[model samples]
Target: MVNEPSNSANGGARRPWITTVAILLVVLLAVGAYLKLRPRRIRISVVQPALQAVSSSITTNGKIEPIHSFEAHAPLAVTVKKVLIKEGDRVKAGQLLLVLDDSRARSDLALARTRLKTAQAGYSALLAGGSQQQLLVRQADRQKAITDRDAAQRQLSSLERLQQRGAASPDEVAAARDRFSRAQADLAQLDSQVRYSPQDLARSKAEIADAEANIAVAQETIRNSNIRAPFDGTVYYLPARLGAFVNAGELLLQEADLSQMQVRAFVDEPELGRLAVGETTKITWDALPGRTWQGTVTTVPSTVVNRGSRVVGEVLCKFDNSDRLLLPNLNVSVTIIANSKDNALTVPREAVREDAGHSFLYVLQGNRLHRREIKLGISNLTRVEILSGISQNDIIAVHSFSPAPFSDGVEVKIVENPS
Candidate 1:
């Protein structure tokens, strides 16, 4: 009977330990079963893999700029008094866009008109005979000169004959000789007086013409006070306000033909050979979503490379502006089709991944995912051209719920999409 009750208590303590171990073993088995039944996460997209004619195009970033942009400036200095057009108003060629105070111009024009009139009058006078009094005076002087010359010649002959016969003294002969010489000189001077003095007449005429020209120039300057549109365009900007004083060549407005819109895009050096005049282009704008505008390469920039960095040159594309909505300075993006090939295999762009300067994609066959190395060609934002390593029907996983390291023989299940 020794210590039998204490032995029962020790037995009970051992029983508790055995029960705790059994519960822990059951919990472990339950956890392992839950993990085995858990679902795997996978992302799937509805993809269409096909072979069709695909054009290899180059996409570049660029901005929309007007083909005809110009700054309207005043030809002469004047105070602006009234503006006819606002910032966004369409105007025709020769339409008045603004008007200056023009008092100065008017005065100038009046002066110019006077000059023109004077020039015309002077020109008229030149066409008609010179002054009658002047003509008469010339005729009289010419006649007098002829008479004096005749009398001098007669006197000289008489003196010579008298000296030869010794009827006239030597002194008398010399005196007659002097008188004849003096008469000849007077006749020559009279002859000169009869003709017009070229210098004097020319000076007077030139003075009159100059005065007339000044007045005419003033008139033309006044006419220019009314600033007119050079072409049919919209007044895009007007810097001068009414009653504002402006100087010659000051900015009046910036006008551009909204109807004449174009796209200018730059390319990298390596792609220089791909662009040429008459090549087709596809234009897209963030402002106009989902719509692609057709354009043509109208001008290939002559600048082949950057002078400093030797980068590629810019190319210009012209599209018909029929909609009349395209404006200057609107941003745009362009795609240049370098080549086109029929039945080229292409896949979604997101399917490709980069590794060590090579492109690759995960191909799904049955339940296995295989990493397929690929060579790429041209690519748009939505699709990429597949040059090699993938067939038309091969299923390429575009997205995954979790990206983890996978062995070669790893199996994956594609998640179903909601109907």
Candidate 2:
């Protein structure tokens, strides 16, 4: 009887332990089923569109140049004799800048003058029949011929009268007549030699014209040897030194009126369409840091060219450089304000997505993402101007933390509100 009571006590203790274990198992199974069937929510960051001022600009590298500049080059191969002005000297119009060794030029001018004088003398001789010596010789020859002809004519007349009276033979009279005819022919030839033909006069005139042209050329060369400044400017470059020899067309000096300056900005070909005339430009140079100059775009590129490995267009800009601090051939940084607007609707560039030539944004509606097509306007590096399709009050999803792609009706968990 004692052993049966102990067995019943142990069975009662084991039954309570089994019921507690069954209840724990049922609770765990219900929790797992609930967790597996629950909906998933992707974690995302959201922002609302804002209204602010935005500007679209293009930053590029540019080169500074003078608006009104002059470069002097050697007119011919010559030695630099005198350098009157040094580099960085301010000069006036018609000022003598340098002098070249003009010995050869002067010699050439003298030779040309002598040739002109000779040509003039020859032309004068042609107009006046012949030279003085030739005229005198011809005159003497003509007088001798006239005297011979008169004597011969008298002889022929006497011979004819004598022949009629039988004092002179017929053969003698014929010989006297032949002598008179020969004298007349000799006189005619001498007169022809003293007179100039029309062709001769024309040819003489042509020679004079040629000589005059040579004189003009020689005079011009002499003037060029004396280098002079054609306009008022500053001499920024001087390559001609005293006694240095230079060849034709070699650069001697460069000058400019540093009151105005021009900049040629090289812009990438893709951003060329955004450039326009009259746009505001800001310039900065590494040599003069912290100083910025304002300018205007005077012209846009007409063609595209290759710059290094990039295709770019050259944009021209003009600015007032009255202080003369900016110089020519300086490389500078250029920023052109292509477009600007006040109080325009803007959103972070990350919020917008493009697909198949269409731009859209994912709007957060009641914790779900909705794809809405939006129109975009001017954009910069960080933000873009929203032209249409979403109001500033609507919350938009920039990106999701999960790997799942965002689609319409996708539930989202707001991880952080950036805006």
Candidate 3:
């Protein structure tokens, strides 16, 4: 029965195949159009603002120092005679720390004493009218002058009597009177030499004073050669060695009361305004790992200065060091608590954006980002305090996963909801 197939039968069979093919093409076209025209949702990271405790702080390098410290220096050019204590030794007030060679000072003192003695002798002589020898000479001269005057007076009287009686010539009487007058003048000159004028007394007194001042200075120099602690402290630096020569004003030793300490912190110039007195500070030393010290800002920088490659301000901080674990001039790290708040509405700092000097945040509303201006309070390394324009329950976009920029009214899909 190999007979020709009917055209209507074959046509009916092909029609079903053609219809299925056309339906498949229509489905693909519809899918392509939908993909090209539909709104794109960007994958992003989102976070919810929450109430948290936040603190703003500044950290910088610092140096440990003593609050009340003492330093001893060589008072004059001398050799160190004795070292009574070693470095790091605890000392009491008035404790002798070192002694310098005071032979020169002693010699100077002896010379000054001799000068003072001589000056005093001269001054006493002036007060007593004159020196012992000068007084003796003046007394002898006065006695002789008195005798001569009396003799001349007796002779003048005799001459007058003789003249009246015509026993002596007029020329002899005149000569006796002249002798009496000359003797009287000589006696008067000797008396004036014994008395001292006011100007002479003052000059003598000044010499005595000058000699006494020299003696005092020499004595002080001798005393200073024996170095002593001014207060109870630890000797942290001892540059003077036994038998070592040092110049005047050379550093000998340094000591401090370790019960309290200070830190000279160098803060960047831009961070100076945030520093205030009484602010809490935390300190740590590299030499002592894991150890921490507490302090407060005592002094703020008045001016900025160059520190290495940066401009910085020196801040003073005071703290207690009852244990005395820290040493002077040791480099340390400091943290100043600029501001802190508790139970503040805060969000991730990355969530906030800046535009035209104003802060804004991308708030997620119904799966779409909306730019809303925000008032910020304080900020920390990781979080920022939201003063207004947002609630703790509000969801905000932190960052986007795609390269496309965020805009207002843009749809987003949260890829990461970081806690």
lDDT of each: 0.75, 0.90, 0.92
lDDT of 2 by residue, 113-183 (tens): 89889989998987776899977887787899999989989999999999999999878998999999998
lDDT of each residue in 225-272, candidate 3, tens digit only: 999999999999998999999999999999999989999999999899
Tens digits of lDDT, candidate 1, 29-129: 99998886674434454354667667767788666777877676776777888889899988898898888776776676566666666666555544443
Model 3, position 324, has a per-residue lDDT of 94
Question: What TM-score does candidate 3 reach?
Answer: 0.80
TM-score of each: 0.60, 0.76, 0.80
RMSD of 2: 4.9
Better of 1 and 3 by lDDT: 3
The residue-level lDDT of candidate 2 at 137 comes to: 80
Better of 2 and 3 by TM-score: 3
Prediction RMSDs, each to the true structure: 8.1, 4.9, 5.0
Query: Model 3, which residues run further than 4 Å from truth?
Result: 1-34, 141-203, 417-419
